[model samples]
Target: MPVTDVTTDHEALTMTLTAEFAASVDRLWKAFTDPAQLERFWGPPGWPATFPRFDFAVGGRADYYMTSPRGEKAGGSWEFLEIDEPRAFAVLDSFVDAGGAPADGLPTMRVVFAFEPTAAGSKLINTTYFTSAEALEQVVAMGAVEGSTMAFNQLDRVLAGLREYSAGKGTQTEILDDTHVRITRLVEGPRHLVWRAHQEPELMRQWLLGPDGWRMSVCEIDPAVGGRYRYEWEPLEGMPGEKFGFDGETLLWEAPRRAVTTEHMTGTDFPSTLNDLTLDEEDGATLITLVIEYPDKETRDMVLATGMTDGMEASYGRLEGVLERVG
Candidate 1:
């Protein structure tokens, strides 16, 4: 019900609706692009959709049908016109028959979905252009407005479920062994960009901070075996001059692929830890795996109890944004 407005222009034969969702741009993008997720909310309540063929790319086609409470089915198809990942897309939407042919006398509209990042989360603008005022009125009279509102409302619930799933997946901390803890995430962007973000001092400052209002003040890295690196952070406003820092020695370095280091945190009871990072690329995305080894199980448990996993997850979320900007 966060839909701000729904407007129709008779002269232009267009209808536009605006709504906002409490989800990140990337997550909403998945809701629209992923077939399984799309089906979960693409129809109004009590009228679920099933997509038999969905190809989410430029020039791709999608064939789907929605079922009514009485078991009647209405088929539709989408001819993708353009796509800009996590931003916008356009398609020709039309009614279809069971045999996969266009239904006679049904209006075909040009539809556009635009996504924008906002303070709350993301804003979605949906616009549909018809060939004539009659076509627009015809669809509107057929409950297009109410149906869309209900479908979007359903989307809100779907996004909420996705958030719950992501929080669990993103915050998962696995004990690989008595001395090792590992965390992994599939990041959006190429492997090289992810690697550079980890290696370069300037890029590190953008996302290395674990929480909001904290900034990295010092970041120095020598990317070579046996080289030394140091990073420091301080609160941006409160507790003037209070700081935390870490210095490390690189034991192994492989550009854009792997890194191994021994890290010692200053001003902490924790012991020095061995950190290993591995990056793998697949189809324009990267999977980053980070493993940290402690001296013993007690040290690992102690660090985990300090909410270190939550902080690391927060830092990883910021890194996703940095990758988008630099990738």
Candidate 2:
């Protein structure tokens, strides 16, 4: 696969995200333009969609809400700018309130989504505009980049599995970069037990880190396309700890299977790594692969140079212990 390029224009507070996937451009088109399909994989499970009606033609409108999996409401609107079959789409991505009201400073900006055929598959380019540098920065801080990329990722998966999509679990995930860590753990335990450890928060917290005074502040997961999940950690007392990290990461999470995460750690000098974890049941055991993608080559180099592979083995040992215990 070709690389996903992210180019920024600070003066205009704009960003252009370009990437290719293993599917045809036409297939990718419908997932974005069709209302029914959009709702199907738009948010993680439980994300409330409000498209009283969907108009895909020029001058048509589409609106959606990301209700917390528990049903708390959040909304946004889109106005089609230009649509060229299987080739491109342009629109205004406006952030709207619960009452469907647009705000100032956070003005609606133009979004241009282009599709191009490639030998390997299809390429997608997302160009988004903003009014000012500060506004762009604020939106990035608000997690816009991660969210949009993740949503596009969902679209990629749905298109790839269109035949089975009508009955299959949508997209798994694709590596956006070659940076970060890669770990392949061979498990001897039953997959069901390992699956629970991955899906259940309480089981996850124990093996992923030392249980000494470690607390998980947030493990909320909706677990479906367009659903939301956040992992927040805080320090606890009565523990011997390194200058541990305090952090949180939230992004689109599809359940029982697929998801994307943007992990940001504070208090430690670690770079943000986009983490993707996948599972497959082999025989009676589970095959789990965790891939962490760093922002740049330098970050990746630093991580690898730190003997990260050995460290991961140690961590997986902890995970194995937990899985066996739970099993």
Candidate 3:
């Protein structure tokens, strides 16, 4: 169920989720075909999808839009294909700008949802395709794995609610794949300067956000292939946070170019997630692409639910501040 076993190259971030459900394939088919059921769980929670008009057919389409908190709008259309009743349905999807204009950032995802009739009920599965590996990574960063996982998980919960009325219990679990989630600051400085600041444990403790009395104990790196590394964060008295450390071996380390580290986590059933750092020098500055690959789609979704992206933006902001002050 590892969702993040992906390439650090933004072009290689594509992955898929597959799970079985104790419901009939036909029952699951309606969940997707029926607009009433879809509107309930479509488009990750909080930002609801408004299905203004839809016509489900071979050449039919689903037009929808989302309204952001700041009142900005995003709209898109879903084109259906090979719509076999109660068994298989395929659709091509894309993100459109406000007022239904096609945008360049998103790849046209080809999604195939299949329903398998089982002895108990139906097993639902979906496979999504990307135009390019980089296209997949772009969406992943934009929260593709998280968003799709959230949408399906929500749908599962919704179906479970309906199953209760049918005198049955729902049984489904969304498992996530190996993942890592952390902020890599992209600053307006040379890669060497930025790397030195980040590799410095003392500088990290000075600017990193923590409740109170929170400090970084170690910031060690080998910075070469076959190198092992570890870092620890300890919360002092009244810090209001748990202390943790990443004690994983580095799988790839090509100095100032790319580094991949395996992360270990306890206190949860799940264990390790993989993380990668790709440092690309752009215009004398480095575009540090930091990626966390989860062990499963479920864990990845959980990380997304925590709004880690916003936290990342915040963390990177701190990294910038530290760089400015130190410079």
Which predicted model would earn the best lDDT? 1
* lDDT, each prediction: 0.81, 0.63, 0.62
Q: Candidate 1 — worst ten consecutive residues by lDDT sum?
A: 162-171
Error of 2 at 223 (Å): 17
True-structure Cα RMSD, model 2: 10.5
How many backbone clashes are present in model 2?
Answer: 11
Against the true structure, candidate 3 reaches a TM-score of: 0.46
Backbone clashes under 3 angstroms, per model:
0, 11, 29
Instruction: Judging by lDDT, tell me the better candidate of 1 and 3.
Output: 1
Off by over 4 Å in 1: 162-327
Which 10-residue window in model 2 sums to the lowest lDDT? 165-174
Question: Per-residue alpha-carbon lDDT of model 3 for 1-327, expressed as tens digits?
Answer: 212222223343335565566666766888788875676557653344668878999988898875432234677788997788988888888888766766776678787777777776666667677778777767777886676665565565446543242222111122323443433334555677666665566676665543335676766766554566677777776657777766666675445555566667534446676665544343455545455667677778776787555545555657767877877
Worst 10 residues of 3 by lDDT: 165-174
Q: Please state every model's RMSD to the true fold in angstroms.
A: 17.7, 10.5, 16.9
Q: What TM-score, to 2 decimals, does candidate 2 have?
A: 0.49
